[model samples]
Target: MTRILQLTDLHVFSTPGATLKGIPTRECLEDVVGYIQANEHPFDHVVITGDHTHDEQRASYEAVRSILTPWHECLWQVPGNHDDRLLLRQVFPCRSEDGPGGTVNFVFPAGHWLCIGLDTHWPGEVAGVVEDQQLNWLQEILQQASQEDVALFMHHPPVSVGSVWMDAIGLNNRERLEEIIRADPRIRLVCCGHVHHEFQFRLHQADIVATPSTGIQFSPAGTSPQFADESPGYRVIELNEHAFTTRVHRLPVIKYHPAPDA
Candidate 1:
């Protein structure tokens, strides 16, 4: 079996002890990483969906790299709205296939699965975009990997998760992306970040799921953005030749809580 760990929304700041919405992001990330190292088995692939740094600075990226050193060799990443693509590439050069300044997308094969990471980052915008270029690229990849089951990783969800604020800032061109997914039966799972909460939405043959952040947790209920008083978490995905399984694992305790009106 091939095991993959999906970690997202690190939001580490350049300043070591900085916090976002009252949560010390770097500390939370360190705790999450430590917990994984202490409790889980080695993962075949460590996929980070995005939002690596809230400040998007070189120092912040480097700090994130240091915390995630254990899985660096098996790491795969894509950019999020809060990320600086160039800085991220500079820190983790091998994580993306793109050049100095290109969309950070990637693809690899694992057992009977074809794992693909899509770049949904839209610079200077909170919302994400799935351009025709990416769609065409995905089409070509799917054609080539026709025989294998597909698992997609991206920063933004292509479907709404019922949060008015989050849905408004979701993938802008989801219709076209959905069209492509509907045409491909091989696409079995689509794991996403950006929502900063756990959610599952079925899109035809694919299970489009959103995972919790490794730092801060978001509430899915409010019309506006709201923080959840919950522990940071990660997703574990186990894949074999014919089947796959996944679950969300969170820290046993909520080390820090968000301010009620932050």
Candidate 2:
């Protein structure tokens, strides 16, 4: 079996102790890393879905790199709405070489599964877009991997989780993406971030999952955006020959609370 750890929505700032809606993001990430070190075994791959830095500055990315040094060799990433693609590629030079432009995507093999990270980031927009070109690319990749079960990782979920505010800013062309997933039997799992909460949805035969942020938590109960006073968390996925199991692990306590107006 291959074990993978997923961390997302870091929202760290260049200035070290900066806070996002009252939660110190960098410190929260540090605490999450410490907890993982103390309680969990080493992961084969650490996939960060997106939102590595809030400020999109070089220093912030460097700070994130420092915090995740232990998994540097096995790290895989994709950009989110809060990220700068060019800056992220520069900080982590081992990513795909799609020149200096276009979307940032990745594909790798893990056990009996082929893991693909889709770049859903649309520059200058809170909502995401998965263009025909990117979807075509995905199809081509899937065609080549005829025998391997597939797992998709992206920042924005392709399906809505019933939150009015979040669904408004979700993947704009979800129906197009959904069609692809429905037609592909190899796709068994889809992991995502950006909602800042834990959610599970079924898309045909695939399981679409949304993980919580490493910093602040969002509540999906309101029409408008609402913050949840919950501890930071990460997801653990274990894949074997033809099946997989996953679970979310949170920090022992809630260290910070979101401001009412934040």
**Cα RMSDs of all predictions?**
1.4, 1.3
Q: How accurate locally, in lDDT, is each candidate?
A: 0.91, 0.92
TM-score of each: 0.97, 0.97
lDDT by residue (143-222, candidate 1, tens digit) is 88845699999999999889989998999888999999999888899999999999998999999989999988899887
Question: What TM-score would you give candidate 2 relative to the actual structure?
Answer: 0.97
Instruction: Provide the global lDDT of candidate 2 against the true structure.
Output: 0.92
Error of 2 at 185 (Å): 0.7
Tens-digit lDDT string for candidate 2 (67-128): 99999999999999999988898999896446223888888899789999999999999999
Model 1 RMSD in angstroms:
1.4
